[model samples]
Every structure is written in structure tokens, then in C-alpha cells.
Target: MRRESETCTYWSELIAYLYGELSADERSEFERHLLACAICREELSGFERTRAFVRTWKARAEEAAVGLPAISLGSAPNQPQWRQALAALREFFALSPAWLRVTSAVATLVVCALAALAVAHAELRVSSEGVAFRTGIFKRPPAQTKAASSEPLYTQEEMERIVAERIAAARAQMLDRIQSEQLATREQAQSMPHPSPAQASAQQPDFEHRVRRSEQAAVALARDDDAPRLSDLLSEISD
Candidate 1:
């Protein structure tokens, strides 16, 4: 189990190295390891054999395709020329493992994308400024001069005038609010029923009498702290 796990670790590395997928430093490092590791060396040899077998299979497939006699389209109505070519291509790769096939497909796609980009004159740049990607007959419009702002600029005097106007408007709004509150209060008061002159005169004596009695009780309580209680005031008032 331990040996198997250790070999498995180098499995991907071996494949990458075989496919020329590793960078210079990684490839150098892997080559040094490969020389010392018996398991990796053995696995690498096995892979090389498999790769050679696949290549031979592909060559034979191509030869078989070439050796085939050209037949009229009507003679083989079910198998089209394009279908035959596709079948030949499939047969060519069929000997290779699934991983190898997938890797080849992906590598081919990447190569095609890069080729398209090169043909299109695609440019990609990264710097402190920012990442920029541009393609095809693109001239970066001469770094536009900071466009003069379209907004109207105010002079110091104009700015002061605007601030003064804003302050005046705020004051006006506050005055309007105060006026509305006062008007609402006045309207509310006017809506309420008012006592007549006779009613006012009648309540006035009782109100004044109550005030005089409260003042006298307060004075007595101040003069005698012992009589501070309301019950004492009530007794005095009763008397």
C-alpha cells in the first residue's frame, strides 16, 4: 500500500513530463527524481511503450485510410466521406488512454485559441495602471486629455451667493413650519368651546380662593416643618 501510494504521487508528474507539459525547472527536477526512483523509471518506460504503441496504431490507421480505394458516394450511401474521415480519426486516437485523449483535445483547443488571438493581433497587458486587452486595428484613442468638465463652474462670489441663497431658503422653510404650527394651534383653540363671561366670573372666585388657601398652607408649612404633611394642611383648612 505504501509503495503504491508513493508511485501514485509521481503518476501525474510522469505523465506531464512525458507530454512536455512541465516547465523548464519542473522538468529538470522531475528528471533528477526519475533517475533515482525505480518505480517512476519503470512507470515511465511503460508509458513510453504505450505512447509508442498509440503512435504506431495511428500510423497504421492513417495508412489503412490512404490505402482504401475511392468509392462513389452512391456505392456506400450510408457511409459518407466525412463520416469515414471522422471514423478514421477516432480510430487513430482510440488506442490512447482517456486521459491522453482529453489532454490532447484540451491542448489542441488552447493552441487554436492562441493562434486565433495571434491572427487577430490581440494584445494583453498588466501593470500598476490596470489590465488592458485589445484586439484588431485598435488604436487607443490618444490618452484623452482630462476632458474639461461639462458642468458649469461657479466663481468664489457665485459660490458664496449660492450658499447664501440656500441658507435663506432653509430659513424660509423653518419660518413656514413655525407659522403652520402656530396657525394649527390657533385653529385648534378656536375650534374648542369657550366659557361665557358669567361662567368665567363664577369660576374665577373658586380659582382665586383655592390659590389663596394653597399659599397660606405653604407659608404655615414653611413656618412649622412639623406641619409639612397634607393631612395637617387639610386639618388646618378644615379648621
Candidate 2:
């Protein structure tokens, strides 16, 4: 009983394992569990025996159906094909587990119900008006149409104004988004490590070199008669 309780969780897997339906990892795991589980071992043994018995029974039934001498009354025919099929079907269900039998019964009932509905010319419709079901030999006319909503529709100018307002709102949203992104980027930049003095100096253009270039440009400009001298400009600015 303890073993049965322990095996309750694994019972479904046991069937799959027996039928080689489990994947590689699952098969390995179950096999390892089986080695330690006496309940599972015993269950597997019983299942094997039952399967063998069923196979033997099935073979015998088939042989009997084919090879057995049909004792018949004068002019009476052998068993019908349907009887054989029914027998086979019965055997199949008999061999199946309870769940399969219940499922088959449920499926059969559903099929029969659907077939009955089809034969009855059933029709179902759902609309704003309401749900409707019809069943008859002849087709029924469509239901009355629902009344349109009382709300007024927008005119062309109203639609254009609405579109313009939407565009403005969208543009404002884009601008706000851009501003937020710029702030975030600036904050991120500030959060990062500051450059070392040497690194900073290396990155900056040479101030003395820039001054020399400016002086050279000023001299060139001074040589041009049309341009004012740097000295004169400085004196003028000082004055």
C-alpha cells in the first residue's frame, strides 16, 4: 500500500515508459527510479503479464474467426463482417484503460450530438441585436437590423481640425521625448569617470599652437592693405 501511494505520481509515466514513449532523459530518470522502486517493478511485471495475456487472447480470437469451422444451419451464412468488427472493437475497449473507454464514450456522444444538430438544420447567430438559434427544414429570414448609434458623426472640417490637434499633440510628445532623452544622456555622461589631467590635456588642442596660427593669420591680414593691423585693432578696442 505504501508502494502504491508512492507509485501514484509515477503511474502515468510508467505506461509511457513501458511503451517506449518517454524521451531519453525521462526514460533514464524513470529507469533509475524503477531500480529503487519495488512498487514500480512489481507494476511493470504485472503490466507485462497482462499485455502478454491480451496478445495471446487476441491471436486466438483471430485464429478462431478465420480458421474455426462455422457451424451453420442449412443456407445460413457465416457471421457478418460487422459482428467481427464489433467483436474486435469490444476487445480493444476491454483491453484499454478506464480513461480511454470514458474518453471514447464522451467523443462518441459528442459526434452523435453534432450529427443530430446537423440533421436538424440548426443555425446559431450572434449580433448587436441578440443571440438567435433556429432549427427547421427550411432556412429562416435574417433578423431585423439594429438601429444606428445616436451620436453625431464629425464633418470634414471637424475631422481636419481633429487631425491637426492629434498631430500637434504627437509633435509635442516627440519634443518632450527628445528632451527627456537628451537629459538622460547628459546625466549618463556626467555619471561616467572624469578624464585624468594628462588625458584631458592630450585631448585639448594646443593653446600655444592655436595662438601662433592666429598670429600668422593676423600677419597675413596685416600684409593685405585692405585689412587692418592686429596692433591697430587692439589699440582701437583698448580705446
- TM-scores of the models, in the given order? 0.28, 0.31
Candidate 2 lDDT tens digits, 67-143? 97534334222456455445546655654567788999999999998998899888999999999988876777789
Where does the lowest 10-residue lDDT sum fall in candidate 1?
Answer: 69-78
Question: Residue 148's C-alpha lDDT in candidate 2?
Answer: 100
Which pairs, if any, clash in model 2?
Answer: none
lDDT of each: 0.65, 0.66
Clashes of 1: 0
Cα error of candidate 2 at position 174, Å = 99
Model 1, TM vs. native: 0.28
Instruction: State, as a TM-score between 0 and 1, how close model 2 is to the true structure.
Output: 0.31
Candidate 1 lDDT, 46-101, residue by residue in tens: 55655544544454466667896443333233554455556546644653456668
